[model samples]
Target: MTPISSLANPTIKHAAALLTQHRIRKKSGQTVLEGVHLIEAAIKQNFTIKQIIIGQSALSHPEVAGLIEQIAQSIILATDAVYKQIRSLGTGVDIMAIVEIPTPALGVITSDCLILDGLQDLGNIGTLLRTASAVGISTIISTTGTAHLWSPKCLRAGMGAHFSLAIFEQVDYEAILQKVKIPLYATSSHTDKVIYQHNLTQPIAWVLGHEGQGVSEIFLRTATAIALPQPNGQESLNVGVAGSVCFYEMLRQRQFAQH
Candidate 1:
């Protein structure tokens, strides 16, 4: 296909604006995926690819033959200048797509699970996901104030981990409580129960707190609060790191009992 001649092409202009504004994305009910890695991730997660825009120069420089072939959209070609102008990153990827956001499933947990309350760092959210996938946790329920799992940065930082598990985000505080019936162990700085002493073989949901503040008091009023001991001078750990630590301890204990 020859390079696009019209900078005013209705599709191109719309996509350009859509990339810059969150309102347009929400109104349109679409999320943009940049680069081959993210495009591939979205596909694996079964997100609908509404459209794809590829730069003329990128055609041969870094061929995403696989992604292009898999795309179900009418691939719109753009001039290198036009591509550069629309991309959010300085060194833009060869392609970008406006994808339909996958609505979070109402997951029913039959095994160990992780729950988050208002944890908002994209990097932290991603790290928690990667760790969750590694530690035999296949389900996560993210409640009020947590970073959106579908957001671009979280997806990228996750490195495709979203495609690996059933993650429910944007859940309400009360909704999460009603959904999880297993013994919920909420993380807190103040707890008499050391994590090691807790029984891990039982079905559980590890409720994690957000940055700056710990678990919400309402949840603590009902759920058991637990803490992991930190020997170093550091008083606190990143929620993602702390959550990962807690998860693996359960994994370790389970593994030990098996041996």
Candidate 2:
């Protein structure tokens, strides 16, 4: 078992490229999943694992050792110096993996879904995806202007939601509109009809817009205008928070109806 101690190693450099350059990741059809939790999630989902790199410090952990032995992929030990260079963003990440990004066809979406319209902030996009996954919305569609759905920053923020979700990116909402038969609700700061007033149990699509521009007019034309009550007079809420509130409300409504 050769340890990857050299900074110039192609594997290390390639992982670095995936983190810094979105085009490289997309072109190669590979993305880096950092941390033990994310790596485990990807494995649990049975996503294709190309390689697993474990830091020297990470090897002592029982779970890390178990994964290295159980996973039938190329496993390399990384020295602290090398690990620091390729480790995923954030604290306590002593393990990382290079996994093939699954390119599943756009098949029928059966569950309630979320539409991200022109969202640019990676953190917001990730948070919304995480929220959507937590609340049982399995399909998420992102329009052209949105952040790269699989970018490392977004992936980190999403935690493991990406594994559970059927995320379609660079989509045209109008084309989606033609295929989806459910009601599409667009969030509006100006709308009088608050979200609480509506029955959200039925399968529907909630369109969350960009931080600044809001939802595009074209999408709005086909969507029901809905607002969240902002009694504190704050003119607006962060797109992530707004989307989460709507998702939870939908859950609450459906759960109550079930009882």
By TM-score, the best candidate is 2
User: What tens digits encode model 2's per-residue C-alpha lDDT throughout 188-224?
Assistant: 9767999999988889888999899899898889888
lDDT of each: 0.78, 0.85
Model 2, C-alpha of 89: deviation from truth (Å): 2.6
Q: Which ten residues in a row have the lowest lDDT in candidate 2?
A: 102-111
Tens-place lDDT digits, model 1, residues 122-198? 78988888898888788888886776776666767777777778878778877777777788888787776878888
Clashes found in each candidate (C-alpha, N, C closer than 3 A): 0, 0
**Candidate 2, TM-score vs. the true structure?**
0.94
Given candidate 1, what's the lDDT at residue 199?
A: 82
Cα shift from native, residue 66, model 2 (Å): 2.3
Off by more than 4 A, model 2: 88-91, 108-110, 257-259
